[model samples]
Target: MEDSHSSTVYKCHLLNGEHVYLKIPYSNVKFHRELEAYELLKGRVSIPELLDYWSGDEECPGAFLLSELKGQSLTREVSPTVAYHVGVIHASMHAIQPPSSKRLNGIQNEFSNWSAFIEKQFYSFAEDVKEVLEEGLFNQSVEKFKKMNQQLPSPDGPSFVHMDFRPANIIIDGNKVSGIIDFESVRFGSTEVDFTKLYRDFLSADTTLYQAYKEGYNSIRPLIDLDVVLSFYRFIDAFNSIGWCKRRGIEKNTVFLEENTVRLKEFLR
Candidate 1:
C-alpha cells in the first residue's frame, strides 16, 4: 500500500494471505519515537496494534514494524456526524496524560513556558520573512503576538496530542472511526493544540460540522476559551511553517506561507 511521505509501507501477506502493514522509517530516531508512541497508545485509542518492530544493527541503521488496522482513509464523504465523532475521539485521546519522560511534542524546547514557546516559535519563523515582509507590518505582527502570549494563562493539562490529526490520518468503518494512523507526529502538549486542524481548517470550512463537533467535545471534555486558544496555536503553526519553508528554501511554499500569514493575522486579531 502506498502511503504518504518518507515511509516505506509494505502490505505483507501471511501464509493465510491475511495482510499487515509493515512500516519502515528513513530515520532511526523517528523509528524509535514512533515505536514508543505506538507502545504508549496501544489499547488506549483506536489505532493499529503493533505486531512487531526491529531496531536494526549499525550496518542497517533503521527500523520497521508490522501492524493491523481496519478501514481506509476517509475520502470526500465526511458528514457532521463523522466530524462530531472525530471530535469526541480526539477529546478522549487528549484526556490521556503520557509519562513526562516522553519528549513527544514536535517542538524541541526553545522556551520554558508553553505560551512563551508559542510566541518564540512564531517570532523565530517570522524572522525568516524579514526581507520580504514590510517593516511596519512585521513590527505590528510582532507586537500583537507578544501581547497575545502575555495574556495566555497556564495550560490546563498536558495530554497526549496527535499533532497531525486530520481527515487523511483518520480511518472510518461505516459511521464509526475504526482507527487513527500516523503516530510519528504524536506528542504531549496543551490539549488546545489538537483542535487547530478541526477549528481552523475543518470547522472553519463547514459550520454544521463545526457545531456538531463542538457539541460532541463539550459532551466529553469541554474546552475553555476555545476561540482564543485556537487562534493562538493556529498563528504559531502558520508562522512556524512559514519559517520552515523559508529556511528550507522551498519557493513552492510561498503561497502556503502567504495563506498562513493571512490566517495568522486573523488569529492575532
Candidate 2:
C-alpha cells in the first residue's frame, strides 16, 4: 500500500484466498503504539483483529498482521447517515479511558493532561518549523500559537483520541461505516483534538453533515463546544503538519505542505 505515514503494508492471502495485511512500520515505537491501540480497542471498536507480531531483524524493524476489514476506503463524500454513524464510532473511541503512565512517577505521561500535552507538543514542533519557516511567518505562527489558549475551552477529559482520524482511514459499505483503519497515532488527549482532521477533510464541507455528525456524537456523549475550539486545534494541527513535512520531505509532501502553509496563514491572520 502507498502509506501516508511511511509504514509499509502488504495484502497477503491465506490458503482460502482470504486476505490479511502485514504492516511493517517505519519505527519500533510506531509499531508498539499500533499494537497498544489494537489491544485496547479490540472488542469495543470496529477495528481489525491483531493476528501476529514480528520482532525486528537486520532486514526489517518491526511488523504485525491484521485481519481484513470488509469495506472500501471512504475517500469521497459520504451520506449524512454514514457521517452520523462515523461520529458515533469516533465517540465510542473517545469514551475509552487510556493510561497516562504505566508506573507511578516513572515517566511524565504527556497524555495525562490535555493542556500540558498540547503545550509541550506545540513548542516542540515550534523548534522544527523555525528551521524551515521564514522569519516573518514563523513569528506570526508563534504569536498565533501563543494566543490559542485563551480561545480554547477546557477539555472535558484526557480520552483516547485517534489523532489521525480522517476520511482515508474510514471504511464504508453502502451507507454504513464498516470500520476504521490506521491506529499508529492513538494517544490520550483532549477529545477535542480528534475532531480536527475529520472536520478539515469531510465535515467542514457541509453544514448538514456536520450537524448530523454532532447529533450522532451527542447520542453517545455530549458534544463539546466545537465552534469555540476548532480554530485553535486546527491551527495547532497545521503547525505540527508543517513540522512533519519538514522532517519527512518537502517535495514529496507538497500538497500537505502547501495545504498546511495556507492553513497557518489563514489562522494567523
The TM-score of candidate 1 is 0.78
lDDT of 2 by residue, 33-99 (tens): 7877887788898998889988778778789888888888774467889878988998888888855
For model 1, where is the 10-residue window of minimal lDDT?
104-113
Tell me, by TM-score, which candidate is best: 2
The C-alpha TM-scores of every prediction are 0.78, 0.91
- Error at 100, model 2, angstroms: 10
Give the local distance difference test score of model 1: 0.69
Using lDDT as the measure, which candidate wins? 2
* Residue-wise C-alpha lDDT for candidate 1, range 1-269, written one tens digit per residue: 54444456787888986778778775666676677777777777888878778877775535556566667675446787877777778877877775668564432322236676555557777878676567776677777777767777667567777777766678877777887887666656677677776565567787788787778777778666686676666766776666666775557567767887786666555
